[model samples]
Target chain A: MNSVVRYFTDIYKGVTSLWTGMKVTGKYFISPGEIVTEQYPENRATLKMEDRFKGEVIMPHDENNQHKCTGCGICEVNCPNGSIEIITKKVPNEQGKMVRAIDKHIYHLSMCTFCELCIKTCPFDAITWGQDFEHAVFDRTRLTRVLNRPGSSLKKKEVKS
Target chain B: MNEEAVKKVILKEDEDYIINMGPQHPSTHGVLRLEVCLNGETVKHMTPHIGYIHRGMEKMAEFNTYKQLIHLTDRMDYLSAHINNEAVCLAVENALEVEVPERVQYIRAILDELSRVASHHLWWSAFGMDLGALTTFFYGMRDREKVLAIFEESFGSRLLHSFNTPGGLMHDVHPNFRKHTREFVKYFRKKLPDYKNLLTDNIIFHNRTKGIGVMDKEMAINYGITGPSGRGSGFSCDVRKVAPYGVYDKVVFREILYPEGDSFARYKVRVDEMQESLNILEQLVDDMPEEGGYTAKMKPVIKLPEGEYFQRVEAARGEFGVFIVSKGEKYPYRIKFRSPSFSNLFVLGPLAKGGIIADLVAICGSLDLVIPDIDR
Candidate 1:
């Protein structure tokens, strides 16, 4: 008789405990205002990434079509995956002596882990992180981009003064 | 044929039933394959087969410099990414013998507690789903997002923030870091009671977990299980308590323990730990130094002098140790990581031997085996 009473009490306790869990869920179920999910594609127009998001590497050019990269290949050397390559060519400096200058600053987006090693190691602030994360492409060659625009030269102030 | 010969043949025909639990299954959490031997629904013996997701991180560390190696540790035990990064940083700093500022210490303690709470939230969500409570996932994720948002705001990455450098942080934390952390602590404290109301008091949860996987204190010590799982068996092995690092020496928090040595005890240790993490954050937030620079004077090229160095810290799951052997080079001679999951995983065979096959999931979840940490 005592075992029978204990069995029923156990059932009652379990049912009550289950109902308590349901109550917490039911409160959120009835109120749609408590939903935390975001509709991703629909909200793309207004979606704002954090300012410091390390999406990809970019070389910023000034209005005079001048960049700060000096073809030192510090970024190329510092990159763990060899993501950056600075092709250099001979050019005349202030004294008219042939010196190494960046011909093209190549950045491989596909190889970047976005670890920010390059940006941190750059002495001239030559490269920075771009916030645009949409990098899908059909051709693999498109990811291998030349960061310096056509006919862009080194900044005047960036030369050894 | 003789009747005795026919009876012997019939008895020999029934062999041991063997099955594979995962290399793709969800309950295993990652690509861990368990070869479980069974007899009439009772698990007789089990062996965990790892190495599905091994990326050869230790071998890769041989070539990469000390700064670059910091990010690789993030991949191992990805949940405790901050603490993993700290292990490498502390190891490198100790070899270099550079002392980081008080501000860096205080900030690191805050991030450690925040990531610990986030990791516990994820474990609670997945552990509940393993036990057939689906609603817990959504609730757990909802609160976990608030912590991730705090991380995303400061570190610029949500999951694997490799923010720690050899000397200090890669950069200073954002101005709102303290304010947002305080807000999260206040908000999460109120919701912790809801977690209790939903799961802790539920009789079904208790019945499913209560005396299921019993691992005693002596076995826990023998296995070197040094996390919440070990603490569940009343073995006090918190690295922070045993050997405090960073600002851990300044703060006061209890090392949560339970003598029951059951699945429920392990569950309660993690749940209670989330509250203790909040206590740590509260003590740390207001007391953070306002002026000290975020990073110390670190050389551009960090080459460790010579000999070996090791650093251990309390990860969300257990004690994570980093062993580095430097021969006065930019890269390490050889690197080894003493991950908790690798040691904690072997004890599962003994714990699950007599239990039903269904209880295997509960035992695995209680141990909280992050497979990549094991494989790496």
Candidate 2:
């Protein structure tokens, strides 16, 4: 008789706990305020984020598409993963003397770890963080981007000069 | 006849049976070996042997470039890949003197919370299975798949996603990241109560778990427990709120806690934590910064300035600490990863000494022992 009473009591307790837990879930399901889900993409017009969040990097350009990068190769040397490469050349100045200019700045997106060490090492204010994230491509070669263009036609260079 | 039956039931003295729970034991979670000394059903003493799954990540981090180590961090807590990546990225970002954009910080916080929820769900499912609740295994996996789908859509990889870099994120959030994460959290939130009802509220599970493998608050503190494991014993040590990294402090969320220091309490801690995680996700989806300069102007070839920096982040398991020593070079001199599972695994021997064999399994599951976290 004692064992039978103990068994029934244990069953009652088990059922009560289970019922209580289900009630909490049911409350969320039944009430409109309980369901705290927000639809994405459809509601992306209303999406938001904090101000100081980290994203992808970008090289800032001037009105004439003039980039400040001198191609000093500091970013390449500073990158731990060899994600940056720069080709430097000596161009003839007004005095017919050879002066250094960045010929090519190659950025391999695949290898980039985005540590941001290069931006700090840059003596010339060149690369900055970018916010464009939809860069998915089927071909890996597309990720390797050239940041510098041939010939310098810039008003900013005259200001600095 | 009664005396003869009693004699048959008596144990034969001096006879010992050894059952070795090898590194392959399913219930052991990772490659943890245990030599069980048993006299019939009662376990005399259990000798747990570890270090089978050691990847020597700390030692390896010394050779790999700081950038390369981020992927290795993913292997440490394979389930919480984003959290591990965040810890490593935060360390390198600090060392390089790079500031993350406000938008990326919020994204990291949201993803880390989602990872925590997914990890807890996996733990609950496996713990129930350890306790002989077979139905929970299917239910747990189904819920975990929802979280994984969100991870895939946002990070491009479900597990071991090396999505975070030193300065900030590898890429900005996919245009659909916020929408997918919110949807996943909603569905997962709806499904959690079923788990509670099926397992926690079940009579057999409660009777078997409650008061079994009780851990006092003092022992829990002295052992340096954190996350759900520490919360089970009332530690309330949540790094997200404590240090406020990656925009976690700016957001509103509460750390779930339980005063009881038993196996069931630990289970409750993780269960309630999933809900809190949902709460954080809800807020993140509602307040995602849509437009911003996501990544800072950190150079492509990053060299760490000479210095020692300690970075701490709350992983799904507990506090993950990374201490990096650099000599103003591309490679770091020393990288030490203070893993949460490594510390939590120590409590098992002390907790399991006098408990039943089944209770040992209970404590192991409650502790949420991830072998890679221990081995890392």
Candidate 3:
């Protein structure tokens, strides 16, 4: 008699658990507003990521192409993946004093872990982040981009008004 | 046989044969080995042999720079690497007195939740497979792959994203990450019921699991089972709810509870926890702050101040902790990791006794033992 009661109680609990779970499933399954899916490539334009999402390493340059990078090797030294390589060359200013410039800023995208250590190490806010996440290439050489602005590498200082 | 008659069999089948079931079995999850003494198909005693994957991470942490050690953490519990990274970063930041930007903190919270969801997805999928449901395995991978794609877009790594840093985040959030998360959450919200009807409501699976591996509230606490496993025993020991690290305190979410403390109950608890995580993710995506994403900055070599710092996060498994002792040098003095799987794996012996050997896999699955975590 006791075993029978135990058995029925177990059955009751199992039934309740199943019914409760199924009720939730049934409700969600049949709901009108329940359908939620987006086709990946089809919805490419609308593929949303958070505004402040961190994606890739970027070096920011001013409109005049004057960069904040001081040719400081801090970013290169701090990178865990050894992806950043900064080569400094000194150029003579109008005042005839030597001004250090970053000759070649090489970033190997393949080896880069994107841990952001380079950004953290930059005392100057020279390197900002970019969101160009889809950087795959048919050729591996496309990943190693030199850190130099196209038109103007570094603009010369104009006379004060 | 009746109780009196069963005494004869119990007495006669004394020295049961012991078969070791892991440190290698796919069902053991990571690297846990269970020594099971069985009388025919019935389990007499079960002891879990662990520490095979002990990387001496804590001791190694003491020697490596805080920044270098963060990478080391990515290996400890490889499933939820982001969460592991976040927990250690939180502790290091606390010690350094670095204030994370509001936006960064919020994003960390969001990513942590995403990690939780992903981890649970694998758990549910693997748990189902362990119990003989092969289709759930494919479904799990399909759903999991979507999140990994999103992760790759957001953090540039699939399995182990060391996105979180000591001071703050490496960079600001990607513009697409929020939208990606929103869509992912929406997608998972729909996929959940497909999960339910496929596995949860199955009468046969329920029969196999319901009464097996029962652990009440007291036994659960004593055994140090945590995360969903402990909660299945009615202990709401979520560090997010209790301690409120990162941005969890700012939001409202339910502490999912299952009072029965059985194998089925724990399994059900994880499924509910995933829903709860989705709910939190929805709220977080809707209201992610725009201010403060990066901390001030750190040295190039990533030096640390001298002191001991301990940080704990509510990982999908349980309390994932990192204890770092800095010698005020480039490298740490010591680093000790308290993984949830380690403590949770210790309970297998008591759970397996008197249960059928077939139920061994089921009970282990319910506990969600990720062996790398136990071994680490």
Best by TM-score: 1
Recovery fraction of native interface contacts for candidate 3:
0.06
lDDT (10s digit) by residue, model 1, range B141-166: 99999999999889888888989989
Candidate 3, residue B364: Cα displacement in angstroms equals: 1.2
The best candidate by lDDT is: 1
Model 2 root mean square deviation, Cα atoms: 9.9
- The backbone clash count of each candidate, in order, is 0, 26, 24
Q: List, residue by residue over B256-309, the lDDT tens digit for candidate 2.
A: 788888999989888888888888888888887888766787765568888899
Candidates 1 and 3 compared by DockQ, better number: 1
Give the lDDT of residue B205 in candidate 2: 87
Over the stretch A65-145, how does candidate 2's per-residue lDDT look in tens digits?
788877678788767567888888887778999878778788888887555557655777688655445579999999998
Q: lDDT score, residue A93, model 2?
A: 74
Give fnat (model 2): 0.18
Q: What C-alpha lDDT, on a 0 to 100 scale, does residue B188 get in candidate 2?
A: 76
Fnat scores for every prediction: 0.62, 0.18, 0.06
- Candidate 2 chain A least-lDDT 10 residues: A48-57
Between prediction 1 and prediction 3, which has the larger TM-score? Answer: 1
**For candidate 3, what is the DockQ-based docking class?**
incorrect
Q: Rank by DockQ, highest first.
A: 1, 2, 3
